[model samples]
Target: MHLIELSIAKFEENLCRLKASETVCSSSFSSISQKLTRLQDLHECVENFLLLPLTQQALAQECGDKWINELLDGSLRLLDVCGIIKDALLQTKECTHELQSIMRRRRGGDMSFISEVRKYLTSRKDVKKAMNNALKVRESNCTDKNHETPAVVNMLKELDAVTIAVFESLLSFIAGSKSKSSSWAFVSKLVQPKRIACKGEEVANTNELEKVDAALQSLVSHKSKKSDNTIQVEDVQIWLQDLEANIQDIEEGLECLLRRLIKTRVSLLNIFSH
Candidate 1:
């Protein structure tokens, strides 16, 4: 194999290495730290390959070889991976903050948090619509040349499914929150705002109240188990925390899938380099 082919092979190896790093780091408590270190290593590996002397000569060749062009294309794709990793890092941090905010607000007795949750839930429709449109466009744009097509399609599908699930969880959390929120107003004869004024809120809160007894049977695994007399703020807090955690996890998986797609495409370009 020529110097160019050898370099392309090295690039493919790094692609595999990047995926392997994710698998290794996923099982650990320090996943965030491990991911960052692995990502930095990936950046260095690709950067070094791109800056090699022979690789430069190959790109600068007078003959305009097809292999050289493929190498350039693959390298460009790797640069796109760089942008992806950077954005993923920012998103991971954002998700963490969002998760903590949910926990903090619940402890501080923030009712407005429910309003925010509802707003985001409503926005899910727009998000799904936009994602559907993007998926259609991506499917139409797929060509045999793009080796990342399968992974891209899988990523989009998983994202759509996860988004729907998260939306439903948020709705459930809102319902649970209302139940706990309304437990204080005890005058059953008087029309409660949540119990009667708002149809959606009424069902969510009332239904939750009805299930409080049954729910306790399953709460033995939790740290604090409360009796059926009260709707425990901790119950709502746990529900919200679970929903937030799901969103954070989905974001991470999507980000990783994207990086994998980019890497697969880079490797394909290398194979086609010959």
Candidate 2:
């Protein structure tokens, strides 16, 4: 995902440079074409990652003992790459607009090129929304109840670290820019605490397994009361199965979220290159 994002940014940079120039050269076209090819390959890789099975047996066999930590690390890298790609895409849109304005001032340049750029921009926006939603879902589901397993907690902590790194990078990137003071300052304030809070939650959850167990027991007991003693036994059994299934689902969801984030980053790279 990082590779894809970097390629995309390079592509966009080239695009902007080419647009700014009075003449379009063969080398410029070749660069854009190569970036486009790489973007497509990166998209395929993301799709393959998503299609991978998330079962413990599969993960163990494929990634061994370091699966969880490695997955988390990869996810974080992808998030950072995607974030940068998204920013690049936004900048690309502005560059395209400037190019359009320049073309409009020229004698015979076609204005329809602006419409094509708008179409790509719209697609990029949709991808960004999807990535944001995926992240939100992952954050929402990473709770004590759903992620009580030690492995999951550890993985989440690693993810949190990655998130913090990405957030800090973004803060630095924005701070270094000459944008409006209030806007960048506000973004910095908003992101810093969020990164801290996310990391804090992971730490809290790691040591709160006993509490999670207690809550699970309470939920089971409360639900068991809805039926007679004899029926409650059967219900309890069914409930336990359901609970396990829910846990598994949550685990799978986490994996899916990670994959989606990777894909999002790759897509962003594609947009940047375009």
Candidate 3:
């Protein structure tokens, strides 16, 4: 269980950094690399010892079995966090790369241009609403001081901060390009220019062109239905909502199981003293 617990703690620390900063740097990924190493080691350690008969019997003990259940439940919640954070990281990384590419491109219509700033502003508001809804859910289930702050809430805050930074940078870039003739488009066009057919329709290289088109179609056919480029802001907001609900359930399980473990430990102490 320490494997899961410590990994979660490390993840929380990274999320704290994200919540406090407007940008993610290479430093964040450096820390993540160390975390992945630790997780891999822990997983190997668990597998090496988990199936022993003595270990199985100890896990079956009724006096403290609730702790085991809580640990498993917590691991599931942490996996949910892992999935969401991975998604956010990949999205932010791609967005950062594309924005930089556009920034460095020669000032012309051939590179790329973003949509209006107002649309970005609306998307930011929608993200804020999602963050608020997550908080509302936490407050609804939390009954006492002990249940107030779950790891999920802090994690969601990081997600909110990262998302806001993404849109804010986009808005700034689009705003600055307003006065340029080359950046006059409403929607963006990628750096890859459209293909143009040969003029005059000569048949000298017809076979080679057909072969190239066949190769290109073969490459394009392998693309999946769910590409990152196709995901919407609304899709991310929905994912966050699902993550928040999972956190709520995990927190309840942790509290209940922790109370049981403490009670069992106290009872054992009493029996030994008598």
- RMSD (CA, Å), each prediction: 13.7, 26.7, 18.5
Stretch of 10 with least lDDT, candidate 1 = 209-218
- Candidates in order, TM-scores: namely 0.37, 0.26, 0.32
Clashing pairs in 1: none
64-113 in candidate 1: lDDT tens per residue?
Answer: 45434443444454444334333433443354345347646565235454
Each model's lDDT: 0.39, 0.37, 0.32
Clashes of each: 0, 1, 0
> Model 2 misses residue 205 by how many Å?
53
- Per-residue lDDT tens digits for candidate 3, residues 161-252, read 33333323322321222122322121112111231123113322122211222222222332213344332333323333433343243334
Candidate 1 wrong stretches, greater than 4 Å:
1-6, 18-43, 62-111, 123-133, 139-274
* lDDT of candidate 2 over 126-191, digit per residue (tens): 544544443444432232323434442333333334343333332322222223343233223322
Regions more than 4 Å wrong, model 3: 1-27, 62-65, 100-274
Pairs in clash, predicted candidate 3: none
User: lDDT value for candidate 3?
Assistant: 0.32
Name the top TM-score candidate.
Answer: 1
